[model samples]
Target: MKLKTEVEPRIDADERGYGGVCRNNLARSRGETHFYGRCGPSRRFFACSAIMLLATGLAFAARPSRPSPLPNFVLVVADGLRPDELGTRAVPTPALDQLAAQGIRFTQAYAGAPVDAASRAAIMTGQHTGHGRVRSELQVPLAPEDVTLAEVLRSVGYRSAAVGIWGLGWEGTTGLPTAQGFNEFLGCLDLVHGRDDQPAFLWRNEVPFVLKGNPGPAAAASAFEWMLRGATNFIRINEDHPFFLYFAPHLPGSSSELGAVRIPTASPFTNQTWTPSQRIRATRIAYLDEQVGKLVADLRKRNLDSETLVIVTSTASSDAANEMTEASKPRATPLSESNLRVPLIAWWPGKIAGGRTNNRPVAAWDIVPTLAQLANAPLPKQLDGRSFSALLLSQPPPTNSTRFYWEGHAGGLSQAGRIGQWKGVRALGKPSVAVYDLEVDPTESHDLAPTRRDLVAQFEALFAENSRTWSPPADGAVGAAGRPGYPIPTNVITQPLRTNSPPDGPATP
Candidate 1:
């Protein structure tokens, strides 16, 4: 095949411009002839340059553009916080309410377990309590082989800082946040330490950062204030790059003192006529809301609001659930919705549509994969959670399993699952399963297992498919000691946080 163009060679110039002509550079060698067109004068030069520029622009546009920077993630877990405790009737959380209004709220979201360690483990490892290393509230460290969400993000160039309760592992153990892939860690290391609202010292990575005049009602500073500063510092330092900040505040939760909830100051609630317990709880919640508002404000001030995803959820604890008023309690059982259902709010300005609420069920385990997806990172192996990133973008969500499972080992093996609209609870050694139609009875007050054999069978089948018989490591297997680097003379710094009033007295002046 041959293609040919005929050119009538001529030189000419128009009145508006200089010469308009085309010159051919012809070369012949080895029985081959090549012709190149060269432009002449101002008119031809402009035309030729315009064509070349257009071609270059098209070529540049055709190449794949560089991907947008990965998004930042901030997961804030409030210790012992219950949803009902945040309404106008009790405590008002303006900051949290606004965050929910500007983000996607999950109405039927649940924690991975009824207690801290297991639920936190599930969140970190993307495995439910049935599969994760820390399956119960027992003090245990995650196995070294276990992969954490922080580690997953780190693989894709994220710098992680866990500021607050690193419940999964303690000091000198493989479960430490630093060991688990966090670039920085500051706060309480163990559950015992976490319970101390006025702890004399906190852990900064593997070292003891002493709080010289802390844990006192009249102390010049609060431990929480220090931790919040650490969190904001991390954000300021990593503003230019992708990062994950896990801020878990131990507030409105039980303190080491029996029947006591401690906060530095209960001023706003000090004048309220509520009971001491109620006032303390309200103050703590208010305090938390204020701190959260500040943190988010900091992000906005730094111009990181649009690129960051802030998730606010509560860690479900049976003990914490009981801390609420008797009337507010869901049911006598620990697996009840009141105990398991925690607030799940996701906020990403300019990414997720604001003021949207989704009824789709989300568990604690889903967080890992969701963040991984947002970062375009690879999914870690042996994960049980499916990413809900699509839901964030108002797109069709991932196909989540119809059945959700949870187990707790505090007294004995207790299991619970939700299949469609039916919720079932069964003790591992018991023969009978109590089922409730959650669609009708949101509180699980009416048991239908005795009447609905079909639902029971279905629940049994779901349990059979998902249940795993596993146990936590032996007590001595993992090191539970506090930071060993500190001197014995400073052991006084580890005392329980002090309180100004009795359990029944007013929380503040």
Candidate 2:
């Protein structure tokens, strides 16, 4: 599971056109990058170099030529749900907890970039700062030119489909699950009505579904059953070929008040009421867990579970970056540590032991690469993430790995990279920097900027690297949560196209 060494070869300044650029790894460029329209010779030269590096990494590698399609992999994301919040006597997420036990649970897993669309974009495209895009309400798409996990995997003979949120890209055009790689797309393409609104039906391609967002408990249960039916249908119809199922459940923070709960089934609900904040969430989670368990059971019943690799994660933490002091803001909706830490679990029976945890720093961006590795598909060069296939195989932990970086495109928030024992952070809107001995202060309580001169210098270099790649908040912009349901709100859903999937709930627990 060794990471392939990237060619960081240096060509002559003359040959590389690298002349007269701040020599010796300049920490910070004096001024901002000139716009493409206002570029000079040196600016053009450096820009060309960056493009070359990007091109080299993003090249679509050879696809499998033989008749054998790759193994089917499922990636599930529980939005806004934090890793810590699960399975505690506090939350009792038995299903998620069980998945964590079977898979290598990363203690320091992070969102590629905080927020859904952007972080999800990072996961799909495998590009670090370069692929960061907004997918909240107003959608920004992954550039059509970029290589995607689905695209590459599809090329290698796998049938790929996406369920749940495809928040990136405004419409189903450039940023759609199908366009990227999925052959079929299901679930809510995007959510606006607090996860219980309409669009509320399934969309095969761009066709609108009849089912409204399952605001009622009955609808949720039925919809999930429909999904399982879909999966079962898929397996029955195409059992001969391998397929990738990206199932994203639409159950969000608030579960009870959103809609009707009593569903028609062998098992019926007793008109139960769930409180909004925590209780409702628990109910929603439990229901979703049941659906997952059912899906797994079906797979096992059909002898398909062992052949599938199930990976579940969330786009961001459930809490607000800044605690939800603002009533307009939901309880958990910010970039704070509480709000950004997400759940990531991988389950491959007989491969991943039922109860092992690997607290390495993993991120959503790693999904593309890790999936590619698991399926033995081609790895594109442009991916900024490294696969944790070793951990999935229950191997001993590595002593060290890549430094996870975070920057808030919407919040102007920036952070330090994590080495084994230390961490560093910087202000995105300003030039201030801070460093911490992570071993000593995992909470990042104190800013040792003033006292540790050497640490500051060390971190300054790291921060500079982050800024070059990540785009800061677009000047001054407020996010889309303020304007619910507008197709093109501030950031998440603003592409020129438009497509919406149905919102749904189910007896997932």
In the order shown, the candidates' Cα RMSDs to the true structure are: 18.3, 17.2
Per-model TM-score on C-alpha atoms: 0.79, 0.70
What tens digits encode model 2's per-residue C-alpha lDDT throughout 400-434? 55666666654555554655566666655657776
Compose the digit string of candidate 1's lDDT tens values, residues 50-85.
898898874434223225488999999987677666
For candidate 2, give the lDDT: 0.55
* Predictions in order: lDDT: 0.72, 0.55
Best by TM-score: 1
